[model samples]
Target: MANPVELTILIEKIKAKTAVVGVIGLGYVGLPLAVEFCKAGFRCIGFDIDEKKVNLLKEGKSYIKHIDEARIKTSLPLFTPTSDFSRLTEADCIIICVPTPLGRHHEPDLSYVLNTTRTIAQYISKGKLVVLESTTYPGTTDEEMKPILEAGGSGGLRAGEDFYLAFSPEREDPNNKDFSTSTIPKVVGGLTPQCLLAAQTLYDYIVVRTIPVSSTKVAEATKLLENIYRAVNIALVNELKVLFDKMGIDIWEVIEAAKTKPFGYQPFYPGPGLGGHCIPIDPFYLEWKAREYEVSTKFINLAGEVNTSMPQYVIQKTIDALSENGKSIKGAKVLILGMSYKKDLDDTRESPSLKLFDILQKKGAVVDYNDPYLPEMPKTRKYSFKKTSVALTAENLSSYDCVLISTDHSAYDPVFIASNSRLVVDTRNLIKDSHKYKGKIIKA
Candidate 1:
């Protein structure tokens, strides 16, 4: 058992010296966290079960493009990746940033979290701090997680004495240029004051603000609230998008006009649908938990439904645009502009672009995608077309009757792409030649 004085000195040591920080699951959130710790002058161990990722780190190669190559090449000595759980003994603080994807029924599937906890539990020891950065239910850490870790040890965790536990939801916006992982404020909560103190101290080293919560549930709930807010607002605009599409009015114009209000309105744009990690997945965690309490989350559930219908709507629009050109979707060569979830990101998890592909294929359109980052869309429920063709050139693009721009990738050479293509269906408002289809460009 550690006294308050001892823990205080320990925290001071963490802030002063190069503490060994272990970041498990080297995906988007974990990779950035490891780099942030290394940049903060802490030695970091980026642990992942995937041997390929571990081997890449060993060779100083980075798979994710958003992460700087210089960081991997130059920062190799401070950064390391390992699959061995025994190496976790060297860590002063450990953070779990693995995926918490939804199940088939859209329920919060905690298999990743539970399996990660099981692995971490095997290496359980005294004095090391643990924090869950995965977005999931509020009671995950204190309720489900605690018992699992306790089962691995000889003695049980006495809240703050034997081991420390906390939940600090990662607000990792993958492609956002403005806010970095260090600049974004973090919300942290622990099982007890000591756990909170230790977790807050560690995050404060790399992040701009450490907003301490009273309990782990608050920290967990805070993440869901942020995502749910986005989901609801996006659904509202998506609702308007469909409405305006039917009324022959542009939703983008209405949004621009509304943004003139200084205080009342904050802008949220409607897209093909919700994409990326948090907004599409995190709200479902809250919804799943609400069910355990025998409650219904009507607004949130309905928002997900509305946002999900967007891809079909886009597909219908594409068919209409092509038909207007005296072309049919069946056996028509259709080119999709982007495959990644959003603009500038390589991450395709829960991307609406994939759904659009499925819908297009279902309508008998010969679907092929062109993305600079992702050469092809991987195998999914409907499409197995993950092969990159020639770069988006006029000759290749001109052959297709219509080009549906799903993601606004930064690499798009817009002027050239527009010139070669017969008709462009811009779902993301990428091409601002907003004059709808001079028989050339259609804004879906």
Candidate 2:
């Protein structure tokens, strides 16, 4: 397998754009990646166990809003999604974009990454480049993944000399209008210099910016730190919001004023709670991993705890609102508007809406939600409310005793909801036009 002639043949194929680029775990991160590589003129093969996604993608349709349908359609022939691991040998380059969800005890679960590496190592040959794009704690790439590949293969071939291995963390922000897969600067760190150069060659062909780091741990920590900054700041604002709410002050307005200072205050607004993939989950992975070093990430751990309590807090407020109107939450029909974590995106991974729904149900309220982007939710830790769609009409809003704006999806007209709803608990300041709403809003 380490034959130089075989390696040279694979190199020629890659250089000639005839090499296949196989991507495992074709979800939000992987699909866009396959398209990017295909657009860069390589034949890309995507692997996902979900046959539904494979069928949908093969038909030139995109499930993600940020991804252009036509762009995907054009590259559909070059990009293929399959469920078989035996087909891994078809690719000259492999990228792992699988999920890295937290375990029961909040540990960094490298199971999916390990499973994928073991699968790929079986079919791996010389000159193939493997890049892990899944987010994890530091040292996962060189320390964890490198050995799995070398150990699994039949021949006792070394990592860098026989095959290239690297870690390039995915910086994808779903529903974000500003950044996309290709536009975001990709950070690459490999086990060896040749590994780095090979990975750079692949990414440079597709991504506009590629940053090479000293080692895999550096690249791993870079992603964690980026998300940690967000988690801590959001926690600070959430605390500020709680304090300011007690004083009958609006935190959004305060952020607006502070943002004008232009020097230090980078404004981060409070909401129902922390949601989305990176902010809500990535910080905890580091917190769990830091225990290995016997170092307590107190700030990160506290922020996670504080943010986790926010959904219950919002529910308590809504319950209070109901009680103030001489109504009990037990029989109340509460409609939550916006299910996606952010505005105008179909991604609902790690959305705060899950906790909100569970909390509302625990209070015995009849829970329902409205979101054009989401018709159903994939089950995740401790919460499993199959998303049932309801209209955001005048009558529907009027029926619910309380309407909570869980997520501020862009398409929702706040004026419409406020006018129709009996009582609205606005968490995201969706109904910021107080003059328009005539002060019927409870700013969370």
The prediction achieving the highest lDDT against the true structure is 1
TM-score of 2: 0.95
Positional deviation of residue 51's Cα in model 2 after best superposition, in angstroms: 1.4
lDDT of 1 by residue, 1-444 (tens): 546665776587688855688999999999988988888888889899999989988888888878876777676779889998789878878899989988888888899899988888888776778899999988999998998887765566554777789999999888678998999999999988999999999999899999998999999999999999999999999999889988998888899899999998999998898888799888889988999899999999999999888898888888898889899999988899888887887778788888887888888988888988886556653347656744777788998878899998878967777878898888887787656436588777
**Model 1 Cα shift for residue 349 (angstroms):** 1.5
- Which residue segments of model 1 deviate by more than 4 Å? 1-9, 379-384
In terms of lDDT, the poorest run of 10 residues in model 1 is 381-390
Full-model lDDT for every candidate: 0.85, 0.85
TM-score to native of every candidate shown:
0.95, 0.95
Evaluate model 2: give its lDDT.
0.85
User: In candidate 2, what are the lDDT values of residues 75-99, reduced to their tens digit?
Assistant: 9778887887799978889999999
Among residues 3 or more apart in sequence or in different chains, the pairs in candidate 2 whose N, CA or C atoms overlap within 3 Å are: none
Candidate 1, pairs of clashing residues:
none
RMSD of 1: 1.9
Per-residue error for 39 in candidate 2, Å, reads 0.6
